[model samples]
Target chain A: DVKVTQSSRYLVKRTGEKVFLECVQDMDHENMFWYRQDPGLGLRLIYFSYDVKMKEKGDIPEGYSVSREKKERFSLILESASTNQTSMYLCATDPGDSRYEQYFGPGTRLTVT
Target chain B: AQSVTQPDIHITVSEGASLELRCNYSYGATPYLFWYVQSPGQGLQLLLKYFSGDTLVQGIKGFEAEFKRSQSSFNLRKPSVHWSDAAEYFCAVRGYQKVTFGTGTKLQVIP
Candidate 1:
């Protein structure tokens, strides 16, 4: 079975602190994505990478950035954490083929105090 | 631009009852449609998707959705609801290089 692992299941950070959320997929997929899930807004894409070292901004890219150093690993970076930025973050990957289904990680819950 | 709408914000049903969740889309042409479920503090899981060919698509966990072009709706249905099926459901439409998800509908399972 394909597994997408998130480094941290729960995290708490102070305001103005830098934070990193790591995601690794064992499926050898080519596409990776980062999204922030909120109560009423649902899952809003923050960024996505189709290949290593190539990233694209998504609908809610503001105040967030991502890095894909290796094909299996993707990282989401919060330059300065704030209370408003606290939310459940999700990682996903899509195989490079006609199967457009995206597999998701367990998710990281971040709380900024 | 392609967009998705889940009109129902919340719905409650007793266990073993029938279920239906509505989804609407706005697109110039036929677009890729999808339904996903998210449990509390978990990532969204793909329930089903409609690309082409058949209008009615069966998905995991005994869930199915039918695409209606005339009404611009893709409604999810299940013959019997389970308590474990209570979760937030989202509808999405894939556009150029990205996909937009609806706000989501929260399901409550009553005894």
Candidate 2:
């Protein structure tokens, strides 16, 4: 079965702490995306990669960086976790669909204090 | 820029009751739309999508969505909702390069 897995379901970190959220997709999709979901803002794209070691910033990429060293994995990095950075992070991969239908991970809810 | 909108913030329905969640979008060209369900803390699961062809699209978990280009809407529907259907539903539209999602509508199914 096609699958997208995240490193954590829930995490808590203090302000100024660096954080890493990992996403791995079993399907060898060409494009990967990172999104931040807020209470009323839906999901905002943070970063996306069409290939390994290549990345593009999305609507909200500030305070967040992404790395894609492997075709199967993508990582989101927070330079310093702040209270405003607390949100649910979602990772998705496109199965090369022309319309860009995405497969998503379970998501990681990060809490910064 | 293209965008999607879900007007309802929340809706509650009884088990076995019919359900409909409204979604609308704004795009210059033929829009690619999607409906996704998020269960509690889990990620969003694709319920259905509409690119072209039939305006009415069937999806997983007995869900369906209809695309109305005239109205710029893609509304999700179910004949009968189950208790397990309680979740947040999001409508999305694929713009030129990226997909923009609506804030979402939270569904609550009660017995």
Candidate 3:
């Protein structure tokens, strides 16, 4: 079975706090993605990495960054957490084929105060 | 450029009634289409996907979606709805390299 796990299922951070969200996949996939879900905005891509040490910005990458030091692990970092950044963050991994579907983690609900 | 759209922000259906969620996309050619369901606090689950071959595709939870190239749409449908089916559904399209997601449609199944 394919499994994707996140470091935290729920998180709370104060303003100006540095937040780190970790994601790990056992599928050995080369592509990983990070997205945030809001009330009506749906899932907006934050960042994605094709392979280790490679990253690409998505439509909404402001105030967010990503790290892919290892093939199975991808991390999303927030330099400074804000109230507006409070949302459900999801991590996903692709099977390296554009025609294939992506596997997702349980997601982290972050509350920034 | 490639984009996906889900016209309905919210939909309500009875537990035993039929359900349909609409999705549309715009691209040079038919892109890889997918439908995902997100529970209240869970990750997005892939309902179904359509790349080529058959236009109608069946998915988990007895859900299905049809691909209409002429209409540029891939609408998800289910013959009967269940209370457990109340969740947010997202439509996604993958182009050459990256995947683009629609705003999403929220489904509310009533008992």
Candidate 4:
């Protein structure tokens, strides 16, 4: 079975503090994505990585950035966390096959005070 | 531009009652449709997908969705709803490398 794991399940940080959310997938997939979930707004993509050291901004990438240093791990970084950035963060990976199905991680809920 | 819509924001159904969740999409060409379920504090789980033929696609947890090209809709249905089925359901559409998700419908199962 394919599994995606996030470093933290819940996190609380002060506003302006730097935050790091880590995601690792064991499926050896080529594509990884970061999304933030908010009530009523649903899931909005923050960033995505198609290969190691390659990243692209998604729909709502304003206050977020990403790094893909290795094939199995992708990291989401918040240069300066803010209250508005509080959200449930999700990580997903696509198997690169034409199907384009994404497997997701358990999610990290971040609360910026 | 491709987009996905889940008109109903929230749905409430009694346990064991039949349920249907609507999803509509707008894409230029053939789309890859998917239905995912997210429990509280958990990630989204793939419930079903529709890529091509066989309009009616069966999924895990006794859930099924049908793709209708004429209607541009892929609606999910279940014969019976369980309390555990109460969660946020998302419908997504893939075009090339990008996937667009619906706003999501939060299901509430009444005992």
In order, what fnat does every candidate score? 0.59, 0.75, 0.82, 0.66
- How accurate locally, in lDDT, is each candidate? 0.90, 0.92, 0.93, 0.94
Evaluate residue B71 in candidate 2 and report its C-alpha lDDT on the 0 to 100 scale.
94
Global fold similarity of model 4 (TM-score): 0.97
Q: How close is every model to the real structure, measured as TM-score? A: 0.96, 0.96, 0.97, 0.97
Q: 1 or 2, which is superior by DockQ?
A: 2
Number of the candidate with higher DockQ, 2 or 3: 3
Clashes of each: 0, 0, 0, 0
DockQ of all models, two decimals each: 0.64, 0.74, 0.84, 0.77
* Tens digit of per-residue lDDT, candidate 4, span A55-84: 999999998889899999999999999999
Worst 10 residues of 4 chain A by lDDT: A94-103
Off by over 4 Å in 2: none
- Give the lDDT ranking, best first: 4, 3, 2, 1
lDDT of 3 by residue, A68-113 (tens): 9999999999999999999999999987898889999999999998
lDDT of 2 by residue, B40-73 (tens): 8788888999999999999999999999989998
Give every collision pair in model 2: none
**Candidate 3, position A25, lDDT:** 96
Candidate 1 structure, TM-score to reference: 0.96
How does residue A51 of candidate 4 score in lDDT?
91
Error of 3 at B57 (Å): 1.1
- What residue pairs clash in candidate 1, if any at all? none
**Relative to the unseen true structure, what is the C-alpha lDDT of residue B5 in candidate 1, on a scale of 0 to 100?**
88
Q: What is the TM-score of chain B in candidate 1?
A: 0.97
